[model samples]
Target: MTGTREALDTAPTLDSRRRNIVFVTIVLGMLMAALDQTIVATTLPTIVADLGSAGHMAWLVTAYMLTEAVATVLAGKFGDLFGRKLVFQLSAVIFIAGSVLAGFAQDMLTLIIARGIQGVGGGGLMVTAMALIADVIPLRQRGKYQGAMGAVFGVTTVLGPTLGGLFTDHASWRWCFYVNVPIAVVMIALAAKTIPTVRPASRPVVDYLGIALVALGVAGLILGLEWGGSEYAWGSPMIIGLFAGSVVLLAAFVLVETRVPEPMLPMGLFRNRVFTVCSILSFIVGFTMLGAMTYLPTYLQYVDGVSATESGLRTLPMVLGLLVTSIISGNIVSTTGRYKPFPIAGAAVMALGLYLMSTMGRDTGIWLESLYMLIFGLGIGLSMQVLTIVVQNTVPYAQLGTATSGVTFFRTVGSAFGTAVFGTLYTGKLDPALAAALAGTGIPPEVAQSPAALRALPDEVSAPIVEAYTAAIDSVFRWVVPVALVGFVVAWFLREIPLRDSTRARATELGEGFSMPDSADRVDQLEHAIAQVLRREQRKKTGPPGPSVRVLTGGTVPETLVWAIGAVHLRTRVRGGATLTGIAEDHMVPVGVLEPVYREASQAGFVAIEGDSLRLTDSGAQQAAVFRRVWRVWLDGKLEDWTFDDPADRALLDPALDKIAGDLLDEQSSRPAFAPLTR
Candidate 1:
């Protein structure tokens, strides 16, 4: 029992520290994953030559892409179920292990398998990082942090290829894989030390069927695109079968999600207008961005004959544009608390940039290329952070993780599909251009026609093939420009609602008894008093009432009691024959309280029954209203200077007014006047 108690006492402290650690670990892990995807691009030629499998070169990248795409949605759901810390830590371990395996791989096939393992871990890292941030931050403040994260993403993209090149040139290409090991180790250690462990709110049942269906759907679609025109013709049965399978599985996944008690992807989130619109816009943004970005390096290397380093350098303008714009836009959103215009403007700018880039050729100026990239980056930076903020604001805190992950998942899916379709277009156009370039050369058509055979040729044969590659890639951007324009149209529909910073605090204050200095408090008091008066009248009319009525003044009646009296009078008048009056012959009490109460009741059309001898008709009630209003104003001025500092005085007066009011309002028909009020 002592051991158990000690363990329980330390658990909360341990959990708190662990949670912070987990967050840092996840951030670093995500950085590693994102960096690896781009960093390896610069080193791919070296890797292909080293492994002696040039024909299977694209598989090295495709394997990772396929696994990462399929794992993101699954990991998101698991994080919500098992606790984000657990999934995040597990992802780090998996990523680290995959990195070690890839570093030790002897051939391209082995390296591809290792990358696939890393992709699974990479998917978890990205999804869980987003979901965890949503858990810790309030929605209103989330935009600033998300902007900071976007800056980090931009930094990674800028540095990844550069870092990879440095490693390949200075060290060995294997160090690229080994590099993640230390980062992962440090991240895991810090996470275990600082990351807090929040126990799941309720035990979550794994949606095995839903998971399987979604995975199959995404996997089939990505596989079909990745291999459709490259490994098999577009008209091949394999492509058709995979496409059909993807659609069927996606349909089943939707059906399962809609029926589940606690769904992984709840349909209810789509009910919010902002969430739905932002999600669609996020998808389009990702689609347009990935489609164009995927081929820019190819264009530079093939068309301009630039070295890999030079190609990366040419993309710096876009990175600079993203960095500057995201920081400025984030601060503006934080200060102004508005976000609608950013997306619309960003999409328009991106469309313009895409249009400009599509007009590029073999001899396009380097400055012009940089300008187009800068414009595209600026547009992306402005809109990306705002989309996450919009989605987060529209949902409850508990659903933040789910909603965020859902939007992110769609974005990733769009990126994957966008890259695949555009790659197809580039290849489709390149094959013909290559054939035309090789026309009438004594070289056989079969050798010139094949990418592998063409790559093996001398510099003379390879130059034209490279030129064809550039022009075909440029055609892909032509299509992307229009897609970005469509995104602008979608962005235009995003509705802007001002974020409420103190929504929760306001709700709490209202739940308590605090009231602001306004007529609402006074009116509320009157309503409460009227309710009490009606209840007493009701009991008197039906039950025994054994109290004598008395005329009293000079007291602060409980606000509720006053409202009850007003309510009773209003109800009595509405029922067609009742009246009330306060009889005071000599009193020094302020009349503000009773005057307003009486005036309001009369205005509501009540007759006054005063001292058992004076009764008010409609005209008499109207005549009394003028005196009531004038006396209330006068009494209020005098009462402002008066103070009931003695608790005993307040105690005695409060109960006295309550008793007098209760007894008077309870009388069904009689209105008896006691001794005249005295100061």
Candidate 2:
């Protein structure tokens, strides 16, 4: 029992295989969260008609977003309090339960309540999934993972309506909710197997007061905007009071945050110039991406006369543009170790694209519209992934979850407000234009208001309304130009902190300091295994002669190949590390040649040489582990008939086996030519 308990308490680690599986599982949860955001919209009319609850149709979406807004922030804090894996699994169960209930809901109210439950679970999935990657993956490898996950946003953005439409048309609308069950089951199973049980070492004080205030503040602000001009007049007492109360609530939340220990959003984070700047950029990016995407499809449907699914399909250009740029920018940042350029360029491009979109009118060709979308998407693509990465780079591991969630929270709020404000502005322009078009004409108000009714009208009646709709949408885009410009200006002030390589051991980057890889021998074993697997796959390809394995047999080292093999040898063979001077003596090489050899190894990221001491970097250590595995595999075949019960004989054979392994690599493949072992 003691052994079991100790093992359970050990720090969690995973090799490449486990990491990949976990990543996929997390994406599945994210897809479900994103899908729910838009999927219900396509089936709303059918849902209302079937349930006979037309008055509450909008609540189906509003309730979900409202709860989701609160859940996103709360989940991050709770994950910090409890273990992330526990919270993540609980979220899956809750989301699954919500799906079951939503599918069985008898009334609009029941469905709305079910949706709100799902929102809570979905928010947990989103925040925890993001935080888990930061926990397990080293910082250097995070860019590609983050980039690929960001592309999930693009996929969900385009596929949500399309998938919902197919389910509603082919099967019952309930299938839209039911479909999540299987996918989520698979996700839960994967997470259970692949996710480690990780808990923070200490539980911080929970700021319940601050949490309550932030939740209320966010709810009031969203409700105020969501209801204004639709449910209540902009000047109505209810709307005015909600807005005023929201301000007071938010101000109080700020005060509570300052006073509380372990505030959900630590005020001190804002003092980090990177966090502040990135949060603002994240908000603006969300504003433009969500706001523009929302109205673009509306134009396609109302004016271009496309069906719901066709509207989804028409937005593919933007999705593709966003996906391609997201991947490219991620790879660039990973390789170049620079991030400031992408946002600077992205902001400028985004502003340009929005300006171009504002110029589009009803008569714009489909190809021209796609081009405009592509440009806008390109701009969004460049900036969005970088914001999250930069913030992750800046925050300490302890505060990582909060900083990430904060960025996400602001983005979501910005999206909600952007959509509302854009709608308010568009409708404000549209009403006047619409009234003038209908004046002195025999069109009834109700028919003109109905999209289907308006479309059925003669060209003479519909033409002016289409023109008015075109102008109104264009005005919305034109108004958004300033928001993008603000982001562009703000991007200039963003400090370009050198993104530290997490693979290189640093006391500061690890929140627990020097007590990580050294204190936990298990981490060394896990790293060793992870490196072996990754190297086995890569070593299959052909390579030029690297280090000569014959160097083991007392041959002169080649100037050309020595650095390459010597780096690997130093990492894998130099066990129980000796000082620089001792290593020179052991290798029978002069300090002069070894100095340049160490320099090559350091530059190539194989090892770190601090003063006279030497140790492998994370990358170098992994490669050494690979070498160990290769040696083990070859040595196993040669020693099959031998028995070494004695330590003295075992010790003698170990050196012989290593030398033979080196010779095989040099003679057979002119490289480290060991055959890749089967897992």
Candidate 3:
């Protein structure tokens, strides 16, 4: 229930070599998760033909999607509890297992069940990968990495069908599922070796009720959408009942969150105007973007007379636009720390692009359609990629995991709804239009549903169906224009906050090295005083009879003792930079001991490592200042009841204290008067 950053002295950081390995595994895992969403589309026909289950084809995706959505919310909380490395590893194992099951499926039911299981693991991998980056990378440098991740999404989304088609056309469609197995094996191997076991200082309490309510609510809503008009009439009692139950459940979820000690989705975060606006914008961007994307291929395939693979290629302009803009915007935000303008402009462009799409017809040229798509992609790129950053920046460090997951979860929900709503609109418009188009022709209405049949029909007969299809797609996009416009309006209200600086202060407040003279005598006295105070604090614990929970520091006070402990880990002689061996040589310490210490400093929040240079953290520096003051007062015989009436006293005392502290620490010690390490 408590919210706190890690205390100083135990500052934690992974070495760069390890950090890079973690990043690669995360990227590949995420790519695998992302690729599955689209890859199945190309293989659906082959799957249906092989399994003899046209009725079950859509569930192949729907089951995966429904389960994935639920898992994403839980993954964030689990990562915070179980540790990202373990959660990530488990997710991979499950995903690989699901993939294996899917590849070996004997029936449509088994494949659908396997995909749903895979979705559960995929969801964990996706969110944990994101949260893990926040765990390992310094915030200021994360933009490029986040940008690259976005580019991967854009690329995979466009390329998924092509990859799937290659597997289906040449090998068995089972390869699509089998491919993830090898990639996942590699991810798991690298993960176990490289990903840090970042266990939390305390175990978290799970809100089972809150999780259940949200899951049930979302499941009901999604199921309603999935079944309405497609599986059942919109007004059918079953669809109506699902929608009604979802509303009641969601309302109960909101009410419960307000009462919970640790809510899965904290209602209080909505108070932050930035999070509110960004979340709204995030939802709209997902809604319009995903819906538009789903239908564009339909336009290309039917109206423009292209193959599925060719349809994907034609959508490349839009994907590339999104890719280019995401990278550019990410770099620009990193350099300037300004981001509000991009989302605003991007939303506006997206609206215009959606509007432009509405104007296309059966005769529209492929190049011109691509031009319109490029504009849409530009808009999506500018806004969607940056939403995660803006939300992360607005929340407290304690809430980072929740806030990050929240935005993503909302976007996912939006994507699901977008597909349903747009699908309904497209179907409603197309059915009537096609029926009328084929009225006098010898062609059955079923012919209009089949691309091959429609393509082989006489020109007089096919032209009207194409026109009807183009019109239906135009109508679907026309509805999306307003959603994009709403986002544009929301973007104006998004206030930009300065991104947090890249420092270990947020990591730990413990000071790095002792700056005072190596005066064993003075340090001895100061250490005695600190130990006495700490002993008093530890004796004052009021909790239950169990393992005594020692208080290391005050809520606001940085623990000077822990800083001293962290400083003891430092080997001598690097002012700014040195090779590892050089550092080890200077202090006559083995390189192995120093490596772990450096990692401890990095993670403890005591020190930050920039390339070869290690620097003290803000709190670490503060602790050091306190050390100087402690020594200055003691040397002046003002230790018992000291007070500095004038601010000028610090300047007078600091120089004297440093000189005295330095002389004592370096020359005299076989061991310090007080060995924090031994303690």
Candidate 4:
């Protein structure tokens, strides 16, 4: 194995207590970052009242998501370079700074800029948090922990709007951002105390030009769409120039990706029909979900005459519907391995739900509105839950990291584009509709912009303003119906390939439902494949390949004694030093029981005792290396079914395999602890 792949397995191990603490700390950091994504939804109206640019409402979401999507890519690269602990802490600080700036903003543009800053930090938190998991958690326990972490995203979706409303209603809208400050401060403090500093084993090439051009290109398109009808005429030079410039930059981005050593997004993955169709469907899902989430609160507030808290409460039906179907669909996919039907059904139902919502008017009852929102949420859940799984199942192992991040990247970009388009549609329609309704009544347009202010007006006066708001919201939902239908058509083109056992095992994880920003390295992906192999063997009650080990090691060392030496080596490498008591404690064995094994090894000159520390001698190191090689041979046999056609992919697999071989040896060294140990 090459040195680069050897470094892939370099991670710091902690005692169970410290590991759990660090886990909780990073999880808190992730929760705060994710909550910011949707917390502003219910507060958009009140934010407009203070900052006073109603047309810029979508930018609050667009800026955060756009920068966040860019940040996840860069952060993943940086985490591999600077160390996740440093990146995580820096992210917290940046998030706090952005939160402070946003809390004290004087205008809409300032708040939007601050949100962009927050996005950078939040993106770092999200990506690094996932990376940190592989660094600290034991591979045996990683899947369960990852599934729990995935549930956090689902919880945030349900909580963000309601929490934003509570803060907006009782204290102030600024509290939504302000709340992150103290929670983040506590998280930073806890993280510093618990997380170990583990640097990368090798350097990774970052595609700086590719990342920059794509970011700029996407931003340009969003800008053109946002400003087209609202800030500039659709045919004016400003909007037209923005649109023309974006296309050129995107073209350049594709060109750059082709030449770069390691592109942020490999242009080659699009050649696969599965990846292409999934990317489009992922985009539509994000477009519809975020767009509706942003404006639905606005509709409930202005048209339905509800408080911020009430609006947030009313949006729960959709969130709940999404949560239910997400979990259900993920479970079903795991059991049946048939997934193509979900995206098709989900997109069709989404269109139906949007059409139902567009039909809502002043007289629309709360029950009917709830039902519409529920249908929309269910469709989103079904469509989105499987996109990542399908991509992972079909993409080459070498392209696993890029392909996974690419799916999320498109989803986030779609969210920004959707919000921009939704905003343009809303403001363009509302300006004219409101003017027509208020012209004869002599009411200033500004008075009707604030939901609370409009609610105080006489029934006849408020009725027209309400109708105008309803019409604008109706137009926004109606316009997206075709987009959802397009997703329905695209879903048909997604080819159903046989699911790998590794991918199927992953499907059982509930986190697949919530669709958070996922970035996994090649080593991590290899480990995932190995994990499934081990799980299957466990179920079959497979025995160890003891005779194979004996043959490979020339019968010079007993397998258990080899394991003893390897355990000491692993502990010394990971924990700085090893002691008899520490090793015994880890394995739930008494010092008396472990004393003779080390004593026998020491007598054989495999280990040397210096005071309380145990160190592997030259002979012991040689024996452990032999054992590792034997284990590698066994792992190769167990995983022989996974054959890569490309030599480059095979090359990537070798190093990751080398790393996993060493890890498997270390983990197996502890296996004797589960049974009665016989020296």
Model 2 accuracy (lDDT, Cα): 0.64
For 134-224, candidate 3 gives per-residue lDDT tens digits of 5555332344454355456556765776787667656877999999998999999998877766655545566678878887887788677
Q: In model 1, what is the error at residue 533, expressed in angstroms?
A: 46
List model 1 lDDT by residue over 1-679, tens digit each. Answer: 0000001001121123444455556568668877766666556546654675433444555556657765775665566467667888898889988899999999978998998899888877765665555444322233343334444555675567667756776787788899999998898887676665643343445566876787679778867876677678878999999999999999998898888765657787778888888878777766666555556755665566565556667777876776566666655665576778888888888888877887787668998889999998888767665666466455553454456556666665566667666766766676678678877777765554333455577878777766776677777777777777777888888888764332111111110110100011111122222222333333447542222222111233333223324333333433343323222111223444345545554454443435322245565444333323333343233223223455663453343334323322323221212112111
Extract clashing residue pairs from model 4: none
Which one is best on lDDT?
A: 4
Error of 2 at 361 (Å): 3.1
Question: What's the lDDT for all of these models?
Answer: 0.58, 0.64, 0.64, 0.84
Best by TM-score: 4
Model 2 bad stretches (over 4 Å): 1-8, 11-26, 38-66, 80-86, 97-115, 130-154, 165-175, 185-201, 395-398, 431-456, 502-679
Per-residue alpha-carbon lDDT of model 4 for 71-92, expressed as tens digits?
A: 9988888887788889999999
Task: For candidate 4, give the lDDT of residue 422.
Answer: 95
Q: Assess every candidate by TM-score.
A: 0.64, 0.66, 0.69, 0.92
Q: Across residues 26-118, which tens digit of lDDT does each residue of candidate 2 receive?
A: 889877987887787556545654674433544566566556666766665566668677887888888999899999999878998998899
What's model 4's lDDT at 299? 97
* Model 3: how far residue 369 lies from native, Å: 0.9
